[model samples]
Target chain A: MDEHAHPSVMTFVAVWITLLFFTGLTVFAATLELGPFNAIVALGIATIKALLVVLFFMELHYSTALTKVIAIAAIFFFMLLAGLTLSDYLTRGWSTYPSTH
Target chain B: MPDSETVSNNLKHHFANLEQQTATSKFGMWLFLATEVMFFGGMFVSYLVYRLSYYNAWVAGSQTMEITLGATNTAVLICSSLTMVMAVHFAKLGKRKLTAIFLIATLVLGMTFLGIKGVEYYKHWVHHEVPGPNFHFEHEGNFDPRHVSIFFTLYFAMTGMHALHMVIGVGLLSWLLILNALERFSAEYNSPVEIVGLYWHFVDVIWIYLFPLLYLISHRHTG
Candidate 1:
């Protein structure tokens, strides 16, 4: 839509800088004592980094709306699979143990 | 109104132009990546169940892996991903030579990743960290030998699958380089470059997540 359809040099530099930032952030987070929150914070930063690579670096931002929908559906389905599978395991009852009953 | 007086570029195709072609190719690659996410999703589920069920055993297994190598491989793959994107940029701008250089660099780095991974696997084989009977490696204060098998299972499963992807990606890039050499990819028709770049970056993204989970989680902090 702008003068250039392809990403300019500046966009490329900015994305690389963002990646470096996330890399440093991930390492720093690992150094701290976040306990249960460590994995949470790490995955959060990762998702943001992946989004940047997808939208700008991979040129999803310049894509047609229909293609964007297809891309989004794929990721959404992956998340769906991850969530449902984890929940099934976490919610299972241990009724097989006679000591509890 | 007719082509008798019109140039060859006059008529519009189903898509608007070259930009639209690039867009569709990019989208198709992303959709394909979505399926890959599902592919790895099944493995992650296996990891989650076994990991939770054998919590200490998983940690024991995780301890056998060399974090430094894992971290180093992560950085290497990240560099390759950057090269891959640069290759796409060059292709879009009609620079075949630069694109080929970047693509070749990407392939080399990808192979470098596989080489290092092979070394790690060899170490597993030597140290008996690989899964199956009599395969066990445990640190004095960090793990139980019995539980190390689960760790090795996850270690091989995740990284092994990742290595498989890298092998396939390198082959694809080699083929792309040949196609580029033959003048198949150009500024006007660079969908293949775009598609391959998507695959390469998706692999990098998966490794980005893998590095943290596999390498950096318990750096002398876990009990």
Candidate 2:
């Protein structure tokens, strides 16, 4: 096989194991009703899954340190987008004063 | 004459090497994912506004959905993402046969997801719960029908968009497979596979948020 014709990167079995764990974690999270913490736990597990995907599948682990930082920044920026939007919504009606009867 | 083995033949002229080409492709994919997040952001805003206004109605509306199915889809999607990673890994390892195989598996699972989604949609249809001009579900004794309607509206908009991406992703991997079959993709130029993997995972990521927001919101009880 031509060197350029095929890459040599082989994924590890551990990657599959960890991914399965997170999938289980997500299903488990759904089983529990944590009130507000429900989203928090789900998102937290998602973040972990996202991290594993970025660090391993993308090969950020072996890349230059700066590249890793850039990858993390890209992810956090997405979170920021979600965070800002949610905050704007969750905060609305918080400051509204009801008229006294 | 430069043989295909020469770097010139494998990498685009603008890129200095295969790595550069892959990097650029990955960067472009991430940029696209950013815009996608914003696209879904608008729907989230709508959900917030309406759910806040009719809190109890929204709760009642959520009850119509089957949590088990939502949960199953979420798991299916995550598993597909892992397979996508494996496909990229095979591409990197220069295993042409394995690469094609894994990519095909990922594509099949994606299609299965769409198939399951269609079934769920059908279930919604038979129940007359799908929102639109023909929607006919009663919100029982105390809930506003409109709020439940809004839930289905957002549901269709968001998940429908997600299913569309799954379609596109399957198409993308199909193209990649064709290239692999032609021996155009190898370790040197597997960026296309890597980039496609990025896109496929990003789709999964979007669903991750959607599952919780759409299905689990305000449901502290498993009732």
Candidate 3:
């Protein structure tokens, strides 16, 4: 088999089970009071699950190098979108409302 | 390539061989999925900004979500993704019958997800949570209905856009199913099945994020 071939059945099943486990864990983590860490943990678990799907189920792991670059670019630009916007919102109050700050 | 015979019957003259054709098709699909990421990304950014401003309303609105149904749908969608990938594998192996079977299984699972979502929407409608003329949400901790409406508004927008994609997905699958029955697919010419599988998995990934953000926002029993 070529290095760029689809994953084995065992790999697919393992990834699926891992995804399900993370879903349950995220749900359970939400029940406890972890304060802000709760959101961080939930999103963290979700990012893990999403990475598994992208890498295996979507076959980006087995895809060509060019395909991999395009796929990674999507995430890079998405971060740019979120990071730049949040920077503005997080700093908007710093200049005008020092009393609240 | 022995598979070259199958390719010639179906391949367009534009491509050099089946391998090139498949790679090009997949590249295009990934490009489309990337744009989709940004499409859904806009709603997510707005939701985050509003959520930061009205954390209380997000909690109140989120608490009303049906976690049981949402969680079950998440599991169901993951199951569908597995089936979708299996379909692609079997298609690549030239096992047309098995490929069709798995495709059908994926379609069934996808519909089941949409059906559960419908039940959740019906419940929202019954509770006056639809965010329109009949919209009404009351809370004890001085939560404003306006801000709460904002939560449901984004909720519906994001999930509604997602559901629309699912609807389009099932339609795409149905077309593939028809083409399969017509014997339009082969190991070297199965780009349609493979490409649609990518689309199906992408939709599943969207729900992966949606499940927690929408349903499990604050499931604290004490609160």
CA RMSD for every model? 5.0, 4.6, 2.6
Off by over 4 Å in 2: A1-12, A60-101, B1-7, B218-223
User: What does candidate 2's lDDT look like per residue over B10-54, in tens digits?
Assistant: 677888777667667766776676667667767766776676666
Q: Can you give the TM-score per candidate against the true fold? A: 0.85, 0.82, 0.94
Best by DockQ: 3
Query: Which of 2 and 3 is the better model by DockQ?
Result: 3
> Going through the candidates in order, what is the number of backbone clashes in each?
1, 14, 0
Model 3, residue pairs in steric clash: none
Q: Candidate 3 residues A1-101, lDDT tens each?
A: 26346799899999999999998999899998998888888889988999899999998888888888888898988899999988888687766421220
DockQ of each: 0.39, 0.25, 0.53
Off by over 4 Å in 3: A1-4, A95-101, B1-6, B220-223
Q: Which docking class does model 1 fall in?
A: acceptable
Q: What is candidate 1's DockQ?
A: 0.39
Isolated chain A TM-score, each model: 0.83, 0.66, 0.87
lDDT of 3 by residue, B105-202 (tens): 99999999999999999999999999989999886665677889999999999899999999999999899888777777777688989889899989
Recovered native contacts, candidate 1: 0.39
- Residues A1-101 of candidate 2: C-alpha lDDT, one tens digit per residue: 12233222345456656866776777677667676587688778777776766666655565545455565665566567657876776676765421111
lDDT assessment of candidate 3? 0.87
Q: What's the lDDT for all of these models?
A: 0.76, 0.72, 0.87
Poorest lDDT segment (10 consecutive residues) of candidate 3 chain B: B1-10
